[model samples]
Target: MNTPKENTYTCLIVEDEPISQEILEVYIQDCPQLLLKGVCNDAIEANTILLNQKIDLLFLDINMPKLNGIEWLKSLDEVPEVIFTTAYPEYAVEGFDLNALDYLLKPFSFNRFLKAVNKFTGLQKNLAISDLSSDLTITVKSNKKTYLMKTSELNFIESDGDYLKLYRDEDCIVIHETLKAFQSKLPQNNFLRVHRSFIINLKKIDYLEGNQVCIANQMIPVAVSYREGLKELL
Candidate 1:
């Protein structure tokens, strides 16, 4: 018996074969993190449900009748996170190209199904964290004026003694705030403290050059302790 998770991901299964659909239905029921919304046998039927509801994860089978999985996926203006299920291994590369979370080869074990679901859970967790930070705004006093800054627009923050420099594109503002204090208000997924004196926006990075990261054409040092963690992110 598994307790329900606070954040459950709504899922839809679009597979043509009866045996495959049964296997997926059983697997989804056993996973506490997933909530089965609807099961459809073809892309056309799946499209109807997708338009009427909000699906967080989609278990799509590549080989289907009339507008096959790949064709259907490409047709959509907006698509949910997908996990491609198929007997053919040839479509694996194309599935990943479309940014499917994971590919499930047919006759896959419960363990393998769980692995793909875990990837979905992990992604949802990160998205939840990011959403929290996205809604938050930081208040700082710069140049004798107070400004409320959006966490998403911040390029980076550099520590300068008691003052912290907040960079946004070509503009720089000096706020009388400690680097640690400023970092505490930022999104952990988008911002990371690379050095004690510098915190760079992970998304704003242009390139890496020998222990240094170039953000907006400015080279920032990477500390030894944070190197491994930064490498993992990059």
Candidate 2:
């Protein structure tokens, strides 16, 4: 089993064919954003793993022994993000109807595989934003006071030693927390860590040039390692 990297999504591949499974395993291993949790020969084996573990992404083959992929997926009450893999293009229409992320016809290239994975990443980035309610707020504790802060009002956060400064328009609030710890509280769709010491709300960006981002008149430096991810969101 491959160990998952930090901030990686867990993936499960359900394909009966040894050749198809090998191809998918290779493609998944090459993608840093995805971690293969398990590979199942059929939907029955996949179902057992799904019941016992949390799978974020599923690459399910349309045809299998005992239970076919399409029938198995429909039987699930809570389905994960799915991408259908099959030789038959005839199943494409039905797969999309079930809201699968992408349908990959057999003998697909690595580039095609990447395109499907990118679709999943794009959907994940926008999922929270689409689901966000206007009244959504975060409960924050600073000093002895507990404040309810609107997520929409927040601009950016700056890490200062062991403390963090959360900026909201003209107001700033100091909290006793690490940037990484505070990051889990915010929606991953909008909030992004651009630097080791800075996490900015993508919606609140005034202007971004090179490695510098201006959020509510405050300049935040974007680290080189995080530039690619920030660019993707922007």
lDDT of 1 at 125: 89
TM-score of 1: 0.62
Q: Candidate 1: list runs displaced more than 4 Å.
A: 1-5, 137-234
| Root-mean-square deviation per candidate | 7.7, 13.9
Candidate 2 TM-score to native: 0.58
Worst 10 residues of 2 by lDDT: 127-136
Clashing residue pairs, backbone N/CA/C < 3 A, model 1: none
Residue-wise lDDT of candidate 1 within 1-234, one digit each (tens)?
233357987899999999999999999989978989888999999999999888899999999998789999999999999999999999999999999999999899999999999998999889888777665687889878998877777778889999998999858989888888878888787889999999988888999888999988799999999999999997
Q: Give the Å error, residue 212, model 2.
A: 50
Error of 2 at 135 (Å): 7.2
Which residue pairs in candidate 2 collide? Answer: none
Query: Where in model 2 is the C-alpha error above 4 Å?
Result: 128-234
